[model samples]
Every structure is written in C-alpha cells, then in structure tokens.
Target: MLTAAAHLGACAGGDPGVGSTNPFESQGNSNSMSGTTQPGSDTDSTPTVGGSMTDSDTSTPTGPGPGSDSDPTGSDPTGGPTTAGTTTLPDPDCVDDDGDLHGEGCNAGPDCDDTSFNSWQSCGTCVDQDGDGFWVGCDQYGPDEPGPDCDDANPDASDGSDCECAVTPDAKASDTCAEGMAGALGVIAEGGVVPPIKGSITGIDNGPGNGQEDWYWVEFPEAMAMGNRPNAGKIAATFAVNPGDPTSPDYRFEVYTACNKPAFEGLAATYGPGTPPAREWEFFDAHSPPNPNPNPNPNYLNNVPWPAKVFIRVIRVANDQSCSEYTLQVSRLPT
Candidate 1:
C-alpha cells in the first residue's frame, strides 16, 4: 500500500486533477501544495519535489493582475488601464487675467484686454471705461438728433434715461425756449433729491450761440407755489458742476415760473412778501419755502402755482470747459 501511494503521488504531479478522485485535492489547496500546483493553475504549475516553483511549461499566459494598472477597477467603464502619471489641466479658453471673477466672452461683457488687469470691456470700437454698463463713444442718448454719451466716465450715471435732462445737448433744434426743453425731471418726491438733471454748459461747442442756457421743467407733488393751499409743499434746489466740488461750487442756477422773455416770479401773500412756496431760492439760506402757494406773478399764466411749471436755468459761469457740465437737483421739504 505504501509503494502504491508513492507511485500515485508522482503520477498526479504531472497532471493534477481537482475532481473528488484526486488524492491531492482530498485536502484543501494549502495542504496539497507538496508536489503539484493548486487547482486551476497553469499547465507548468507542477514542480519537482526539491526544486524552485517555476512554470515547467514556458508558454504560460502573461497579463496585468486584477487591478494592476489594467483597468484599475474591474468595473472601469472605459475598459482600459490608466496611464502611470496622469495630470489634469485647466481650460485654455476660460481666460481671466484681471482676476475679477469674470472671464473673456463669459461675463457681463467680453474682456477687451486679457493682458491688462481691470481693463474695460469692448463695446464695438468703444469701451465701458467706468465698468458702468454704459459704453463710451457708443451708447449715447439719441434718436431724433445726435447726442453724446451719458457720462461714460462716471459709474453712478448710466444712460440719461431717468434724468430730467436726458443728457441731451443744451439746445437741440433751432427754435427753442432758450436752450429748448432740455428735459422734464418728473415730480418732486417728499424727502431726498430726485435723480440729477444733467445738461452741458455754455460753450461754442456745446450750447446755443445766442446767450447759451439750459432749461429744465419740473413739478412739485402738491400745489402750493404761492401759498394757495393750507398745507404747503416746498423744495430745495442745489446746483453743482457735473465734476465739481460741493465745497467750492462753480456754477450759476436760477429758478423761474415760466420760460418768458424776462421770466416772472412765483410769490404768495397776494404779491409783495410772505410768498409760501419760496418759488426762486437763489440764496439757498438752507431755510424753507412753500409748495401749494399761488402764482404771485401779475400774469398767472407766466407764474402759475403748485402743479405749475418750475423752470430751472443752468448756465455756465466761472468754470472751465471741463467744468462746463452741470447737474441741477431738487428735493421737497415737508412743510
């Protein structure tokens, strides 16, 4: 029996079987590794009893192991192995040199200059110099006649759509009341000043040739220009060069009831003194005026009260051409 078992062991080493009949497999893989290789191994799996573990059949299969660079995971969708040292790169098109969070062709507007930081965006040949969404030399407020840009240098003033003076030139056509109706700045609200009424000052290049002046018509909410109403509504007017210092103002402004030859006054108390809605406040004593006052003018048509017209004349005085720009603003006082 011992002789027979030795012969069987040697015979099975040549072709190890994994079936129930093979004595090597009677025990598990670890226990049966004496002479033959484990079940389901390569054809050269068998080794000499006293020799090293090498494939006897040199024609053995060669390939990457389960997850050895050959599809790192068995379930890899691509079904291909990943390269050794791969790196991710940024998108070349999404360039933003300004570091302003907005990229070229990918923001509010196209970046005109990718090399320079904080540069303006291209608006045709022009650019939004102030980043105010309004373009310089391009987005001028015009339809009837040609007009200049709506202060593209200032970020606060976009297009002149809201201002009483639509940033239209001082005098557009020939036959106008002074410099024509520059604009109508809506009604005066209770508290703060309305949007500034902007107009270009007098210069051979800007305003009309004959005694250049810009006129704006506005209305107070209530009718009290001449103290006709019990409760009065008054307004405070302020004038400043568009790019001037309030500390040292350098513009001249006047308020009138009409755009007449000489312009009539809007006074109350049946004329003389005690005018309720201080119609013309040239001094700006920081005091007061009435809104619902009556038109103190001898000709009521010229100086009508309340909802009547309040014309503001902004003219160039001792200011440079650069300071030739002016803004007239009105605020209502709670009487």
Candidate 2:
C-alpha cells in the first residue's frame, strides 16, 4: 500500500491534496504544501507563501479591499464618489428694475425715479406741487408758460400778472356803444391821495376822417380847480389804432369846457367860476382859441401847459381812417 500511495503522490503532480492524502510518499512527492489555504481560513484569500504580491492584472478591482492604495474605478487621485445640491439662495429683493422688466437691483438699473410707484417704468416723474386745479402730470405747461412760481402764496399769480405794486382809491369812466371813452384823466396822491380807478383802455374806431366822431373826456373827484387839487398827481391811459399813413388823415386833439352838462353831473354844476362866464373854454387842438400845433401856432406849447384842468377831444380828417397806435401809460408829473 505504501508503494502504491507513493506512486499516486508522484502521479498527482506534487499537489497538496495528493501529498496530504498519503504522508508516506517519497520525499520528492511529499515536498508539496500541507493545505492550499492558510491555517485559519478555508479560502486562499491571503497572499500565497513564497509568492511576490505584485498586482496581477492592471484592470480595476470590483469592490473595497485592504492594502490597495489605488481606486478600483478610476486612476485619478480624487476619484471618490460625489454628491450634489443647490449652491445659492434666491434674492427676495430682485425685481424688474431697468423698466425693461428684467430682474435687477433697485439702484443698479435704469429705474430713475424708483421711489415712486408709477415712476418705476422710466420716463419722467409726474408730480404736481401746486394745487391750482390744473393737472400737470408728466407733461409741461403752455409753450411760453412755465411751472408755477411763488407756489406757497398765490399760484394763479405765479403766471407773472401780479408783479406790479398796488394802488388805492382809483377812478374809472364808461360810455355806451354810441359814444364811449375807454379811459379818463384824474389826479392821484401818494399816501392820502387816491389813484384813478382801474379801467380797460382802448383806441376809438380807426379814423383818417369821415366824421368818425370820437369824444375824449376827463373827471375830477369834487370838480375842484388846479389850485385846490392835491400837489401829488399822475395820469394813466391806454390807446389803440394808429395812423399808418400820416398824410392820409389829418388828426388833432382839442380841449374845451364841458358843453352844457355831462350825464353824471347835472346842469347846475356845468361851468367853471370866473368873469363873463366865471371860466372860459380852452382848446388843445391846432385850431380855434389859438391852434396848439407848433407849425400853425408857435404859442401852442404855452396854451395848456402841464398840470391844467380841461376837457379834451380827438379829431381826425382825411381820405382814409387815421390814428397813431399807442400803449397805455401811467406817469407822475412835476407839479
């Protein structure tokens, strides 16, 4: 049997199984290891005895293992598994700021007047500071007219009409369509004196001649003479329709004692106080009583000097209508 076992061990190719099955085999056959696995385990997972532990295959390993520094799946040093999630937070204040409806910060975009709710869309900011009952929303006032000035006080006055100073106790005159005068002459005082009433002044019908018949008149507070009139006095009046052609219509102005009586004062107080009639009539025209025009009468200047009380009238005579256009004037004279 021993001889037979030796033959079997020698025929088993020196494997551990054949060697372990017959220990009496020849020394050459008994050279095989006792067991293929280590003494503690049934598997040969550990490195083989007398075997160099060089990596057998270059292919990646399947799972986690010991003693291996390289990763199974990849050759990179940072080849670990990775996880992912949101990296940033949404901004609550972001909105369409540029008026273009794109999300952006308040001051970063084209929102000029962003503080205003409606102004966020760009354009101009519509705000009306004055309460003039006028709605100036985003738009401007009239072409020549600008925004309201002196907004704190009178807004209507901001338009520029209330620039001049004020006057007290003024006088005014009026007449019907048949015969009417736009303005009247009167005396005014500084502190105690009253100014002429404020009234609209306009020139009579265009006249070169043709008996247009425009009457000019004046008024006195109590019908007093120049001596009794106050020391401080001024005249204010406005005129229209100027004679474009001087030669066309011969024009002149005249002054005379009021004939008979005016509708305002009764016939009782019509005449001035003097001799043959208490007071005599005077003319400011270039003719009669001594023509006032320098060409016709050199003494015209001396006739009705400044600061004189008189009734005046304007006359025109020519082939066409005639009168020089003039603006309203208010001035004080040296008494």
Candidate 3:
C-alpha cells in the first residue's frame, strides 16, 4: 500500500504508485449527488506534478463563474439576469457554516445543506462527486473503481463519461515482441519520472481473443554515474478502471531485462490487481542500476550515461479482457 508521507514529498524524489490518501480509511462516498463546481473561491486541490494530489484552502476567486445548478439567465441582487443557468453566485455575506469550502445554494451556490461539510441532496444511490452519474462506486475511485471518484473528500474532477479522458497517441503501440527489440514508448533516465502512461484494452467483441502485449523501455543510469539518482528505479502499473469485474483482474504486465529475460525474475515477475481500489491493484518493483566492473574489459557501455536497460511488457492474460484503460508510471527517484 502506498503511504501518505511518501506522496507529500513526491517531488523531492519521484513517487508514482505511492498515492496520497490512506486506503484503509472509511469508504462509502456513495450518496447519489448532483452538481458541478469550478476551482472554487475556497478549497482547491492542486495535483502535484510528481503525480500526487493534495487539498488545501487558497485565495478565493471572486467566486465560481456559476455552478451546475446556476440559472443561466436569472435574478441577481439587481434582479437582472445572472451568469449561471439560474444558479446564483453566493451572497456576499454567505459565510460557509460548514468547513467545506462550498457555500450554500441559498447564497447562490450548490451547498443545499450549509450546516454540513460537502453535503448534497441524497440521490440515495451511488455517490458521484462530480455529480456526473450514479455509476461510480462509493469506496472505489479508480478508473476501474466501482466509484468514490478516487478522492472521496474532494468535490471536483471527472464529469463522468466512461472512457472520456482522451487517449494519447504516445500511449498506443503495436502489441507484439518485435523480434527482440520492440519499439518503446520512451526512455527513463536517472531521476526521471513518467507520470502516467495510459493504454487501452478494448478486446474484440466477436471473437479472436488477444495475444497482445505492451512494450516500454527504460534505461537507467549506471550505478557509479548515477549522480544523485537513487540506487534503485521503480516501475508501477495499474488499470484505470476494472471495467469488468474488479475482483477478477483481466490484465497483467511484467518487467523484463530484454525481450526474453525476466527483470524481477525471482523477486516479482508480474504486476496486477491486489485489493479493491486500483491504486491497491498495483505492481511496484525496484531495480538497482547495473554496476560495471572497475577493471575495464571490452565494455563499450562503460562511459554510457544509462547502462541498465529494462523492458516492460503489459500483457492481456484474462480471457475476457474488457474495454478498459491502464496507467503505468516509472520513477527514478532522487532519494
């Protein structure tokens, strides 16, 4: 399980799979909700570049442009038309009775229950933080998460369109082990961090099950020349959402030294699902940079910046590989 402290200091050293919140905490954000919000005049969540999320109060914008419930052309103080779709901006004196940065809708925001923090009218079904839909599960927030929208506490992110996030071309590739050298998405130098490499697995509907695999090549700096890079580099991967059955993971990936040899061999060969949350369904492995013998033999890579090369192959092992996306992160932390 990824820890909180590790994520807070992520940038100091790269932290990919290590998430921010505690997974062991309470679940069940499953209250059917409705609404939309902007960055907000109150609480704002800053997603760290290192790929961690942290929430805190910041300087309020004058107020949000309008809420999901806003009246596009409605009454304001002057009784003219308003900016929102009938949703009014909060009244100037609309002090938030609840600690949640959101104000009361009566004040022209979405907070119907001003007495409660982050409260919303009960759809009484599933908790949709963005008020997108009732599909996402309460405890789960991963792409595959059945739903709490990852951070259950947060009031923003994801308007809930299944597979709505654009699939970047960089994350796509032919599925095969090309001879012995598959074209990699990119390389990972010492102390480098690859945020999230998303890949889609939309298994064919008719027939012909997949015999496919992904290729990711990472060449770490040599041990002696690692500057401030840590001795070990880590690669972590997890599906965005378990589109089918969360308990039964339909996909898998493994680390390799080359096209044939296993990188984690005796340590850990494959990475896949674990607990319920996709974050918990992770495979995090570390490898030390290859150390070259001081006694120079016929080593052409002696002066090379990166000599420890590893191949990552994401494989479709499940018989029913649903149409879902996966995220892979590689981090060579400074620490």
Candidate 4:
C-alpha cells in the first residue's frame, strides 16, 4: 500500500518519461524540466536552458510584463523632450549687431549707428556732417558731432558747394617820377584846394598910369592827392592863351609859376622878376623867351617853364593900354 500510494504522488506531480520516476530519487519528474514549464514547476532559470543566451531586449518592449523590455510606440529610447523653431537673440559679446557678421566690428563691439539698431537693415553707420569724407563717430544721429562742417555758425557759411572764397591775385602798383616843363593829361578836380595867387603892382604892358587886369592862380589842395607818372623828370606848367588885339604895341601878358617875383627894384623887376620873393608875386611874365609860342598867331598855344617854388615868372609885351579878354588853362604835370 505504501509503494502504490507513492507511485500515485509521482504521477500527480508530472509526466515521468523525461526523468527518473523514483518518488524519493531527489530528481523528481516534475523537478527535471525545461525553462518553458508552468510557474511553480521545478525548472532551471532561462540562462542554463539553451547553449546561447536569449536576453529579453529591454529597450524594445515585447509585451506588457514587468521585467520584459522594449518600447511599444516607436519612440526613441534615449530621446529627451522636444523643441520647435529657431533661436532669436543677439549675442551680447558678438559685435555683429546683425547675425550677418560684417563691418568694422561684429561681435564684442557697438553698433555704427544707434537710432537704427537693426544690424542687417539699412540706416546705420557713422556719417560726416561737413562732408569731409571722414565719419564723425560710431554713429551719425543725435547731437551735431565733429566732422565735415555741413552748416557753420552762419547759415550761409559751410563746407558745402557754394561757400568757397576766392584767393586774391598777385599784383602791385609801381612808383613813378615826373618830367620837366611837360604837362600831363589833366584829371578833373576831385574837390581839392586851389593854387595861390596874390599881390598886384602891374606896369609892364601899360606905361605906369594905364593898367587894370584880370588874373587867376592855382595850386594842389593836398600834396598826397597828386597822381603818379611813369618817368622821373620835372613836370612843366602849361597854359592856353588867346590874345584879343593883334596890333596893340603896348599890350602885354605875364604870369609867375614861382611864389613871388625877383628881388630887383624897377618897372622890369616889378613885372618880369627872375627870382620870386617870399609872400607872393608883385607882377610877373606869362610869356616865355622870344615868343615861346612856335606858331605866334593871335590864337597860338604855349607851354610855360616849370616853376620851382621860387624860380619862375611870366610876362607879356604890349603898348600902353588896358588888357582885353582871354582864356587860360594851367596845370602841373605828374612826377
């Protein structure tokens, strides 16, 4: 009865074909089993069953088992969270205001123009206000900075197109001296003084008791107002003369370029004095030597001798009579 009961326990445990059937053999039929046996059944772990290892791929989920591995949704095993689009921030150290990276400085610098800070867009860069071609600073906007002067203090003053001044030309006026007894082209009186004329004691053309004459004189208003001449000789006095009577033997005319008549005392000294005295002429000759008029007609013209301050005189020869009408133009030539 004990042996039969023991055989019954072996059959209840498992099929006995693959292992020793002895109940107390220690190697029971149920215990001698492969890795595929039901749970709680005696079997070696999977590692010892086959010659090769069948490690379950944990990275790829096969089924819903706690120890079984492997992902089911095709998601990357090592992948982290996801992001979208591109980054959009300027590099603080990057001088390039725009990411393009050109110009004087890219990263680690200031923008050339500040008002328009967009680095890649237009309207950015230092500009010359004066148009001198040099940039003012890192930027062209804001306060008026130093550069080419576009507008100076004066609205009309600037370095612009129409503000350039013309340079003076190289030239000078030359000095000059006058000639002897030669008259220059007369310049119209520009409001100066007249020549000196004084003293009256005439008895040459008239015999002592018959004389009354019309006379005139001239002088420069100022020494500085005289015009310059190209030559260096003394200028002579010139007069235009007209005699009214062609047949009056006692009729005569005279003038003195000097300040006064000669020192001699007589009728001749009174009218034809050689050296002029201090104050003024008593009487002097207007006539030059031996008919100074080359064409001695009644209407001929004459050039008088140049008068030194005290060395000139004039005279006229005529019979005893009163003087007649005449016109006289006198002038000093330039020196």
Candidate 5:
C-alpha cells in the first residue's frame, strides 16, 4: 500500500490535469482517474477554471486605436483625420487708392492720370479748351492749315489770324496807323524808348510815272535822346522783299530831320538805284542831311545834335507796278 501511494504521488506530480490553475503545469495521463462520477453534476470532484485570461498581444490595429475614432484628442469621428489650420487670400487684380475700377503705372489696371478721378482712361482723347479744333499741347496731330494755336487760352489768338500784339487788324500792311499798330513804335512819350521797331510795307503801289511811297513819323523827345550831338544819332535799317509778284521793285529809303509833309512826289536824300533794291541801308547823324552817307571812317565820331523829329520814307522807283510787300526793321546804333 505504501508503494502504491508513492506511485500515485509521482503520477500527480509528473502529469498536469486538463482543468488546472496553472496552464504551464504538465498534463496528467489519460488512464489515471480520481473522483468525478457524473457529467454536469454540481458536486463532481474536479477543478473548474474560471478566471480571465492574460492578454499578451500589444500591437495596435491599423483601423482604429487610442487617440483614434474612440478618443476625442485623435481624429474626428464624423470625418477623417484632423487637418491643420487654414488661411484666406486676397484678390490679385484689385488696385488704386480712390477705389475706382482703374489704376496706373505698375498696377494691373487702366487708369491714366490716376490722381484725378475725372481723368480715368481719358488719355486717348485730349482736352481742348478754346475749341479751335485743336487740343492744347496736342496740335501736332491736327491739319497744317491752322497749324497749332499759339495761345489756347485766348480764342482771338488762333492759327487762322496773325495773333501779333494781341490784336487782329495789326497784321495787315495798310493798317499802319497807331490804332492798328500792335507793338512799340519808338515813340519817346509812350514810356521807355525801346529801340528796334519792326514794321511791314505792303499794298504800296508805284505812281503812274514813279511809284507809291509810305511815311512813318518818329518823334524823339529831348529827355529820351539816346546820343549826344550830330554823331550821336545812328539809324541801322534792313528791308527784305517778300518772295513772289512782279520783279522786286527798285526800292529806296530816305531819313529827313525836317518835319516836311510835302506831296509824295520828289523827296531828297533818297538812297537807291541798285537792282532788286538794297537789302540793308544805314543813316548816321554825323553825315549831312538829305542823303546822309554812311560814315566811312570807323575812328571818326560826330558830335552833331540829333533831330528831335524824323520821317522815314519808303518808295518804289518803278512806274506802272503793282503793290509790293517788304519788311522794315529800324534800330538805333550806339553813339
């Protein structure tokens, strides 16, 4: 009996039971039997394994895990994974400070003269204030007939009329009187005595036998006298005949110190006789009156008193000739 008891102890220690508390224990032999007499009996002599199993699998699943669908800190359940914060952008084509639809310079808009709201996209057409069919500073694009308006501010001074002296009638040759004169005529009483008076000689016809003549009266005041005596007065004059018309008339010029208004017939001190007329003529107070010869000696200086009043006469030497036009420039020389 002791030997049999020893054998049972060895078998129990070597073989593990099917329902044992430790899973690592060895299994017992199938032939060996203990007590359990009936199946599904509450009082059966057998160990019942009832505790929970220890889980060793620690790998997270690809679908969902902590901080995933179940966790609030993970991705949103309604959507997919959470995204980073977003930012808004501005329009690329908008420009200009006035808020107008146009802009200028480097911007991507069409505003010329962006400073002025009224001039947006208006550079293609210019502004004409005077309404002479030509815009100010834009005359080069118009017809040459009326060229460019010299003064757009004044309508009277346009390209169609001679806008000289700011008057209309002063451009004609027949209008030589003071009322029609546009500029200074060297009259001493009319303020400062500015020299170099310019005038035109036109519409003057030669008489039936000789030719027609025009007279200009110049009064020099004693206070405004330029030179001292006889040598003090010097007249340098130039006459340029306008191109066209019958052969340029044989023109002559004469300066008289006396106030003689004799008929336009024979006048003394006349200088002419050259073909096509002399383009330039000069008179010196040092020489004798009535055809005063130009002073030949440069060193010689005359002290003769200059006449207070003088008459400048321009005449055509030929007869039966039509009217001729010429420009006369008279200037005073230094004494």
Candidate 6:
C-alpha cells in the first residue's frame, strides 16, 4: 500500500518542463506571470506583469508609476485615464480692418492703409483733402492729372502754378564794390534800355553841401565793338532825370577808367550843371587825343583798350535834398 501511494504522488507532480513554470519566458510575450502560484497548479495569482501592475484592492493607482514622470500624458502606460478634446481658433474676418484683401494688426496680414476698406486696391482714388483736384498719396500721376501739391495748405500754390514767393530787389551801397569793384550796371548795346535806378540820398553825402554820390560800372564787350567803325571808337552813356523838376538841384555825372573805390580819382571825364539837361559822357583810350567831334559824335570813346569796363558816378549837387529818379541810357553810336 505504501508503494502505491508514493507512485500516486509522483504522477500528481507532472513532468517539470525545461524551465520553471513562469509562462512568460521571453520578455516579448504579452501575458507574463509574476505573482505567487501553486507549485504544480496551472493557475497563477494576478500576474504582476512586465508592464503596469493592476492593484487588486483599488481600480486606480495611489501614486505615480515607473514612467509617470517621463510620460507626457501623466497616466499609466498600460491602461489609465486620458484626455480628449478640440481647440477652437480665432475668426478670420473679425480682425481685418482694411478689406484690401489683407489683414491688419497681429499675425493676420500686412495692410498699411487700414483706414480705407480697399484704398490699396484702388490707389488711384487716394484722399484729396485740399480738393485741388489732385490726390495726396501717390506722386506718379499723368502730367495732366495734378497730384502731390507742394504746399497742400495753400490752394493758390497748387500743381502747375508757382509755389514759391516772388523775389524782391534790394539795392544797397557797397553792394557792388565789396567784390573789389562796383557791379556792371549794364552793357552798351544799340537800342538797349537801361532800367532806371532809384535810391535814397539820405546819409550818403559827406557834408551839407558836399552832395551825395552813387557809383556804377558798365562793360563794353568786344562783340559790341566789332561792327560799327565810327561807333567802335566811341561808346557814349546818356543820363536824364525822369519827370525832371525845374527846382531840383543839378546832378553831376562823371566817368572813370579805373575801378578804384573810396576815391574814384580816375576822372576820365565829367558833365553836369550848365550843360544840357540830358548829358552824354564819353570814354576813350588814355593815349587818344581829346575828342574834337560835335553832338551825335561826342567824345565818348575812352583812352582805355577795347572791350573796356568803365566806372560811373552820379552826384546830387549840394542843396538837393529830394530823392531823385534817373534814367541811364548806354549806346554805341552808329557809324
């Protein structure tokens, strides 16, 4: 009876396989056995599997598991709660201030002209606040179409019109001689009109009866001396008081060959009171003989060489306190 019982125990302890009864021999196996198990029984306690282990007492884990810190989802790798939802974006049309097909303000788009809905689309019709019939935004307009008014404030200064202020003439003494010589008043050309010069006599005189004097210069270019022979040797400058006052003090006119300032002592010729109201001062080379010719052919040519530059002085004789208006005429006598 003892032998039969021993044989029965041996049969009950079925053949021990090649390795232990751990069913999950390879790590690649999905179902692994880890908990305690009956020595020969086929059943195993809840498998503490290679992956996450499920607690028999509770459905969820009390604390974070192995890879809880590394996993971005913050849940057990095997099986745990997860989040699933959708994110809504901003509306496309709400922020588009300018409908120029471009958005403004943030990442929407680059639309500089946000004020007008489609100003960029129709740039030809830009704003014209002054209403001078010209658009103020763009400079590239047709010649006939006025645009880019220089002075938007003044309507009179619109496109195609003068935008700058008129320049006024200011004549001051020493204005000419400051450059080493008086400025050339004008050239001696036949039929040329010498503009009248107006200036004050106040404070210009050295004394009560010394008379006030003004200086001027004139140039005779070689071109003017080329043609007429008789006139080539004679350059005459005439002076007259416009609206001459009979009671007005006599005015003297003198011509000089040099431009020496302060003392125009060159004194090539002189004409004044006792002479006709309209006097013609002549200039000739210094080496030439005194002019023996009469009226129309007065002694005007200078002793200086051709293409000469002569200096002139106008003096208001003593007692002439009134401002004077004078007209000067320069001409090359006809042959």
State which candidate has the highest lDDT.
6
Collision count for each candidate, in order = 16, 19, 21, 54, 15, 11
lDDT of each candidate versus the true structure: 0.38, 0.28, 0.37, 0.27, 0.36, 0.39
RMSD of each: 42.6, 55.8, 22.3, 61.8, 56.7, 50.9
Return the TM-score for each candidate structure.
0.33, 0.21, 0.33, 0.21, 0.29, 0.33
Q: Local error of candidate 2 at 20, Å? A: 99
Worst 10 residues of 4 by lDDT: 1-10
Stretches of candidate 5 off by over 4 Å are 1-184, 188-211, 225-227, 230-233, 240-250, 259-281, 285-305, 318-324
Model 4 residue 300 CA deviation (Å) reads 26
Q: Write the per-residue lDDT of candidate 1 for residues 35-84, one digit (tens) a residue.
A: 21111211111111111233222222344586676532433354544334
- Per-residue accuracy of model 3 over 1-335 as CA lDDT, tens digit each: 32111110011011212332422111223210111111111222222111223443233224336555554433555545444223333344555665333364333345445554424332233345445432333212234323434323223434344434332243354454444444454555545666676675443212111334556676654452354322333333334442332333434444445555433332221211221122221111222223333642221122112226666655443332234556666665443
lDDT score at residue 239, model 5, on the 0-100 scale: 52
Return whichever of 2 and 3 wins on lDDT.
Answer: 3
| Prediction 2 global C-alpha lDDT | 0.28
How would the candidate models be sorted by lDDT, starting from the highest? Answer: 6, 1, 3, 5, 2, 4
Q: Candidate 6: misplaced stretches above 4 Å?
A: 1-183, 207-211, 226-233, 242-248, 261-279, 284-304
Per-residue lDDT for 183-210 in model 5, tens only?
Answer: 3345543133344433333323333213
Candidate 4 on 128-236: residue-level lDDT in tens? 4345433322322223443333322223433445334221111110011112222222232323222432222222322211333323333332233243211112222
Winner of 1 and 3 under lDDT: 1
Q: What shift in Å separates residue 254 of candidate 6 from its native position after superposition?
A: 1.6
